[model samples]
Target: MSRVLALLVALAAPWTPLLRAAAARPEHAPCAALALSPAPAPTGRPALQDAPICKKCQSTGRLPCAAHPRSDCLLEDEVLFCSVVADCTACAGAAWVPCTDCDNAPARARIEEKKASVATRRVALEYIDQTMKRPIRKAESKHFVLVWEMDRLKVDKKWLESHELLHLYLKRLEALYDDYCARMQITDKEFAEKFRVFVWQFPQDHHDAGLRFCRQSAKGGVKLMGQTPSYSVCGNKQNFQDDERLHRNIVHSVTHLILSAQRPVAWIGNIKAGWLDEGLAHFFEDRYWDVCDTYCYQEANTNVDFKGGRFRLAVRRMVEEGKFPPTAEVFQQNVDTLTLPMHATAFSYVEFLLNRDAERFNQLVKKLKAKVATRDALREIYGWSVFDFEAQWKSWVLSTYPTK
Candidate 1:
């Protein structure tokens, strides 16, 4: 019985204080009344010292505190206190949140799009490699690419991929040639020999290489590729969709390319005189008008303006009258003074020369090649001085194509 009584008493002792406190405190007792001391005195200065120390700093004993530092605590009655202390994990004003899974569906889509673009670029590169039989190096700097676009190349939807690829291939080929020349100290003749040999090894390779060289050297590095290789058609597809225009455009462009290759100095880097340059291209290709009609030229009148047409006719009349300029002057005339009228005059002159004396015309071209700028070459070939040739040519043109 004594042992049982002692066990019960030990158990009761543990709970006695809680029961006594509950009974002693009334439910309605005021918290302010229960507080032991009166409110603290106010200090005029900012309650900096009264602020609570950071819990992290207090536990870790590090200065400047971590979470809920002394600098961050707010004071009410000259006593500092923190809204939250134990759970705080960062310095004052810091933001913290639980880790979240980044939703990257949009980002993934963009990455995939970029990959597709890269793949397209690679396809273009491969096409150039197979076509030109040359390894191409891409210009890594964006600046070079931009300059290439402005000064050397342009691309559109019709031939964006194809044209840019060609430009890159050409750049690579030039670089390779320069490198070879530097290493082997080869003369122009030797370089040409090696180049021709490489190109001739395969028949298709030869054709492609020839065309590429012609296209690059001609047109002053302007490359335009379309489904039909017809500029008129390309323009139509881009604007009016007129098929006849397409055919004319093709003839003109192809002629330009061929003549430019044959007479490189006349076209390349001769931007100031594009009129004569263009006239020569037109004159040479005019022979292929029948082919042009077959594609798309009959529906549209592909004639130059009246003034230009008159000029062309006058030039033709001059050739008819045997009063043409020296071959050198003909090639080297400044385009600005040789306006549309002058172009027409020149074209007509060239046409008459070709039609009436094809052999003489051919000989003149050969002579021009030997002495591109010699007055003596002109006098020997045509029996006329430069000034006399000009005056007589003008007189003949005035008689033939009178200004209206």
Candidate 2:
């Protein structure tokens, strides 16, 4: 290689490992690879030690002299052209000394994990692009990559060819992701590396495919639905019947995916309260989407209409009938036992907490993500007992939610 290219490569080469290490442990600073200081000798240069040393110069605050590595600059290279200068890059060049154990077992494990993550991400992206018959750039800082099967969609092939619907879906998701992150107070780096999604065109296809892929069955008949089966994977059944329903299903399923990604515990134990999980997703599903404007920003409950007002009305009826399950009971229900009315109530409860104090809701989610128990997290973050919370939430629902 040319001298200039070699020098540039030497300077840049040290950063690759550091960047990877930093991504794995964002909480700490990247450790610099050092040059091993040699052992002392009476009348000759010291032998190089095994340990690495820092490269900074103490006095000049620049790169240390290579002739006397890590030194302030006492050694001069007399054989080079700029022989007089103690530390001249052109005359007295520096080279990176490979640190021992740099690619140890632990580092190799991390590399493998990163490679697996990238491969999964790439597959999801490719499937979506190819199936949609349109190219899309990979989304940056996104947890879930969407997969759609076009064969199951009910739309005419001519319509698909004419419109840029795929682009719109991706754009909406990107915007929604940003909004979700902002509301949840999630930093970009806190995002999980693995999140996969499949959106099938037909309801039956989505249901069967989800069960087959996840290697499990949903109890009480396989109803058409969208869900996050594992912490990292989510799937949805697209509705050719109603565009609104399709949007809602996508939003609901993706919400679960995002929440699942947030937890730091093992996948099996990472399940949040059923109410919060479903509520958060339902909350986003009902969020207003307008095609007229691109830059419009809507905060929670701002001119928001539950267009598919069934859930809202169902929740109101439950309150009037005095048959609503206690918040404690609802919290105990996993994805399996979550009834229809329970889903509505969950949505209302989430909306109540969010509209009342978004920051407190965020704190509640933060606590849950930290692996705190559902009951304890709610009590600590909201400062209310279960009974007290239920009472407050019921009153808020009865007053604010419309009966009609």
Candidate 3:
């Protein structure tokens, strides 16, 4: 390791296995009630039988954890389940403490249940924690768990601390999840596991995560695009120069994950379905960044010079010039084998079908997930064979795509 990397790891907080806090419960002797010198005859007034309710916790038997990482964990809806935060020394992921003033059995029991769940989740979701020896920061949204090791981030012309950026990225992931589900009509039950993402500042951590999670040995980024898709990238100046660029990287990778995990729980990237695999990822990249900056041929840096990564006009030009390949030929390729130009045509195919009718396109995806051929699925869902699809898509491109 280089001196710079060594220094950063040294600066990071050390991580150890979750250690249960050990403390003796202090015993308190019950105070003897001062009996009236002579037991007075009971008045007609009702006896004071109940313990006073804790006004601080609103009788809920919990107070917020001390030093709560609320700012980092904030989202539109409350983040009720997070493996990383559940280990907070104060509340143990329940985000509350027992209210000492009142004996609310139900509330205290609920907190205990949450604590137990936290411990279980922490053990199950130890992706980066199990791989990296150094201290790591973590955050989660409904669909994604983020492992962040980058110390600082540049967002909107200003720098944000690591904690601030973690929440921001979590929010971004959820936003994309919402869009993906809405477009595909996918429900929460369709997914098998929460997607895992790791952004590392050092090459070693990135490399280790790539091997462990993605099953690939890559220098830039590696993603496992199956049922429980995971992505790990070395987020340094060489691969991602700025925050906006990094955001693009993740959206592109996560799009691949969502499509693979939607149904049938398999990645079609290698099953002669490269057109949809690469096309859908490019579609989302362009959707958010207004440019398709990177291609997933491999997890390496790409300097796409085709119209500055803006492919709509380029694709239109290809169709008009008769430079585009046959639709059947493109459909026969896999993710790792697609040439740069073929990727552009792939995006156009998805654009043509999804824009014209999303419901039909969704049906087509379900068919594909079931191992049906693209041509067959299209014929069944869109009533078009390969030849028919090619003709219609080219005509649509000529009519709707801008010439500029």
Candidate 4:
């Protein structure tokens, strides 16, 4: 072999096994081969004794946060990154305070280091704190910073305090984030920033947060849609009456924000892509809540029974009775212009596309976000014109949805 060719082959040989190992392991491992190294055989010797640990901290030199009930502090790893814990004067989001009873220098130093890391950035998350003159219950998860101010909520048939509610909502936000990523086939690298969401107890608080974060004032609830989307909601006694209602509202709003922030990073709601925008939002709302009651951007959803919120039967009947609007017309309108019936049909259209195949649905969205016209994107991905989509969606809704 030529000298340079031989050198190239030798250099490439080591990488092939490493690459294959990474492919073999679970997704997103930084170095698969190194991580997969076999364990060494144990030597015939006793393990070293651990250093003296505080009984409370167990040698970690950090104590559990006592600001909350013991049950709230005993969180799983997934729930550990919550902002309520971060906002706590005791733990400061670290989930661990220094062990006061014992003098463990290592634990104290580690706790101090974590506190230092979080301390520098507290101001960015302090808008609500500044307004309230008291800390609001807040939490963080994989893709969102959630500020929740509801005093108490009943979750899973049990009443929970403010901090407990924050942890539960943070967990749900992470789950929603995962579902969105899965449906869109998204990667971490595709996103530029995490979402900022606010769920307030009053309209005034909602309006304040909207002005600060969204730069627009709204009464019921409002969102700043696009890349880095924000949701600010006023959980009044009228619209958001209970836990279930509030959860559904947040889901609907976050769905819009996440879609707008993904990849191409633009809100299509105002650009006559309202069908896809509103449809997908409603689709996720129903997917989670089993019925859709939440509405935004004026679909006449205020106090309207609208099939008692069982949209499937309502949509199926729309097709059976031949009352649904024209596909091309509905697709042409902005989000604010859709009639209530049109919004129902829009959800069905998105559902039909998604139920047909999630990957294809993802491709359609990516195409639309890339500035491709909805007509062309539908044609390229599903081989259908808007008219064809209408016919197919109507057929599928009638066949699949329940008559009752």
The Cα error of candidate 3 at residue 40, in Å, is 37
Cα deviation at 336, candidate 3, in Å, is 2.1
lDDT, each prediction:
0.36, 0.49, 0.74, 0.73
lDDT of 1 at 346: 49
Candidate 1, residue 116: lDDT: 44
In model 2, state the lDDT of residue 101.
32
Using TM-score as the yardstick, the better of models 1 and 4 is: 4
TM-score (C-alpha) between model 2 and the true structure:
0.51
lDDT of 4 by residue, 49-99 (tens): 223435776655567677865576665234424555566776776666777
TM-score of each: 0.33, 0.51, 0.76, 0.78
Ordered list by TM-score, greatest first: 4, 3, 2, 1
How well is each residue in 61-125 modelled by candidate 2, as lDDT tens digits? 23333444342122211111111121234322221122233323443343344334444544544
In Å, residue 120's CA in model 4 sits off its true spot by 4.2
For model 4, how many clashes?
A: 4
Task: Return the top candidate by TM-score.
Answer: 4
**Candidate 1 Cα deviation (angstroms), residue 211:** 15
Task: Give the Å error, residue 131, model 4.
Answer: 6.6
The most accurate candidate by lDDT is 3
Ranking, lDDT, top scorer first: 3, 4, 2, 1
User: Positional deviation of 131 in candidate 1, in angstroms?
Assistant: 8.1
